[model samples]
Target: MTTSKRPQNRADWQALAETLIPSLETRAFIDDAFVDAASGETLETLNPASGETLAHVASCDAADAELAVAAARAAHARGDWARLAPAKRKRVLLRLAELMEAHKDELALLDTLDMGKPVSSSLGDMAGAIGSIRHQAESIDKVYGEVAPTGDDSLGLVLREPLGVVASIVPWNFPLMMTAWKIAPALAAGNCVILKPSEKSPLSALRLAGLAKEAGLPRGVFQVLPGYGHTAGKALALSMEVDCLSFTGSTQVGKQLMQYAGQSNLKRVYLECGGKSPNIVFADCKNLDKVAKRAAAAIFHNQGEVCIAGSRLLVENSIREAFVDKVVEAAKAMQPGNPLDPESFMGAMVDETQYRRVLDYIAKGREEGAQLRAGGASLEGPGYFIPPTVFDGVTPAMTIGREEIFGPVLSVFGFDSEEEAVAMANDSDYGLAAGLWSQDIDRIMRVSRRLHSGQVFVNNWAGGDQTVPFGGVKQSGNGRDKSHHSLAEYTELKTVWMSLQG
Candidate 1:
């Protein structure tokens, strides 16, 4: 209710964001209050768009992580949150979702300034985050225990119970949204949560902790720790008190978390990691122009910081050059721009390290004999900006075609047969998601089944709702993020059997 005024335009949003930067909350939220790290260490969170320092957030280490875990453990044991009635817990989460909507603009701006996403796009992330909370809350009371059929004089009961304490480690690409994806279900399952947001974009998660308290969550039930992965992240993963650890990051880091779990309490770990998803275009596709535009957007959107981006484009040989040309034309329209401008279709890289890493991949692409048909260089400015890049004559053997660049770079390949296309698409360490364009229903069904991916989009790209499950296969990591299935990840199943002989 305190947020009575709304920004009317991009200029208003930009101005409001400027006013907010100086006063941004940079402390970690531990045991329901803002506090400094135990080591008194801090890390400067930079505005990737302007290349300016935003604030020095608390750099939580093992000590701070220990404090947060202790608080969460005590809260879970007290049952103030875990033992609350299902309907009451649902009400609290609904209230939290309402508060999120009320503070949507501020939350969106925090992420935009921290990670250099366009404010317009961050607003959409806010919508997704709010919807995620609402959806999980509504399902809390509806999830019911089951009774197993038993013989006479015997009874069996099946129950699902929350894990005691959960630690959510999320990536920066979709900061708030990824946090919501993990915490919503964990909280809905009646578990205390400790969030360790990526250091590159920790602002939004810190802001959400305040709104969570305002929405009537119990003290110590939810907390946020902003720090490096080696310290805070590793501490949580290796903690004996933490019951479950859910992470969305790289495959390399995901492996480390699993190792940490094995070295500690052997707690459950859920991971959603990297991807090299392929978007295939058949010669018999629908409208080439429409597919071309979609293909372009699938890679170039979000400055290509998406985990499931269709970075590899596989086209039939007969139409490969023409389709690549159309895609190049489309990419030209999506050049990087100032993220604060609502009209800007694309934004800067999340930070300097990722910016340089992407440029290195582009260089590799050129050196590996892939043709640079479109933008390949960073825009000259203070911030990290890279335009949409497309490479032609890409082969599976090339470095760019094989790696997950995590930038606005596309590698195009040509295949002569349908079998070759399927083989080429399936030939990768990742099996996250794939996109295909074809009119023949039989071919669609056959190829979709053959492709080794968790989700497949036919005749389009990037199509999915929260109602359906989201995650990946193979090295892409285990566990699902969205839909009813995700709720299962936060809970443990127990079956009780009893017999009466009296």
Candidate 2:
């Protein structure tokens, strides 16, 4: 397959470059400045496109995490940031968003190199990240408390206050976007944040801290600590100084964070975790080819590293074979290539560990009697690359169908009745998100209401607007991330009831 072509000159660069940067800095952002980790340890950032070392990032440890947490705690206690009026806080957030837009190219490049997502997608992510900040900034003052009607001579009211010192652990798949999802709301709500980006893709988070500084955000209000999960992530979760813990990652780690929250200070824990989401396709009224292509893109996008990926495909028996054929054809058309290329649809996996885990799942699927339809093996290269894989004749009990493969692997299963399809989809422990494809309005309404998932997509897959709440049910984890409701997660409500005087 041919790789996507690159831009020739400055004019062509406009299509790809979201921001213009003077230069890319290789450093960590902490305590209001760009600095290296205290330990002086460093890890090499690799370009998955070419399996080359892009740069070296600070290898932070527990000490670094502690420093960041301390900084956040100090900021909160001093009230240098939290004492600001909502409008002033909004101004700071708006400035941060502007800075993010200005630095979009650097952020996108870092994301492409660190996580191996296509540059086009990375640019989109940068834009989304900026929008998230702006959304929360515009929303800060509008979020008001309730005023209850009281008896004569008595006034009753409720007020909302910031939950101080939030430790936000963001995942690698959409590093900057997830960071903004966690940070923008917390900061807008007047809380200090200590962000922990996944070690695999920490560069952008570090760069964002620099941008935050450039935007004139107060010292210690926001700090970025890059380190392994066991050390830095654990410290954040278990820190008594932290008032709330927000995380986006796997189900296993979410459970651990909950435990830490319970043991530490019983602080509020918000998690957006794993998903084995179902994409149900019924023999509908129109456009099977379009549905097939969309299905392929839904699963194959970001190499299927998304938590809401429509991995388990349940199709009606009548059109199963034809749908599978169309999906396989679409998969064959995808070419994993250099992420720097604007046209590349697929790129390498984040790291070797994830690559091996995906390969194991593929092997397990074959051993368990699922027929490999297309693209099962790993790609030949130094970078961790896997082909877009599809498996047919898959049973609900198969490992590939049950587990979150989290790779470019799509499993196809057929069902006869509507009840059977719903049953198959809801069988998993995860209830994050599910996709239903049918032109039948009744079917869409019925299936959407019946599904035990958080966000249900009818005739589409994983398209979220800022106004809508995004989260999951059961093991997929709890607490909404993106809407006006998200502001509630970062706040504490207090009721003031007064007694009437004689």
Candidate maximizing TM-score:
1
lDDT, each prediction: 0.93, 0.86
For residues 1-502, write the lDDT of model 2, one tens digit per residue.
0114544433444444333322445566678877888889887766665666767778777788788888888888899888898889898889989888776776777798788898788888988899889999999999989989887988899999898999899999999999999998899899999998998888888888877887878999998888778878898888888999999999999999999999999989999999999999998737999899989988999999999999998989999999899999998877687676677788889888888899999999999999999999988867888989999999988899899989999999999999999999999999999999888888888989999999999888888777888899999999888888898899999899887795
The global Cα lDDT (0 to 1) of model 2 is 0.86
Clashes of 1: 0
lDDT of 1 by residue, 1-502 (tens): 2346887677887888878887788999999999999999999989888889999999999999999999999999899999999999999999999999988989988888899988888889999999999999999998888989888898899999999899999999999999999999999999999999999999999989999999999988999999999999999999999999999999999999999999999999999999999999999997898899999999988999999999999999999888988999998889888888877788989999999999999999999899999988889879999999999999999999999999999999999998999999999999999999999899999999999998899987878777888999999998999888999899999999999666
Q: Which candidate is the best by lDDT?
A: 1
Q: What is the lDDT of residue 334 in candidate 2?
A: 79
Model 1, stretches more than 4 Å misplaced?
A: 1-5
Q: How many clashes in each structure?
A: 0, 0
Query: Clashing residue pairs in candidate 1, if any?
Result: none
Q: What's the TM-score of each model vs. the native?
A: 0.98, 0.94
lDDT of 1: 0.93
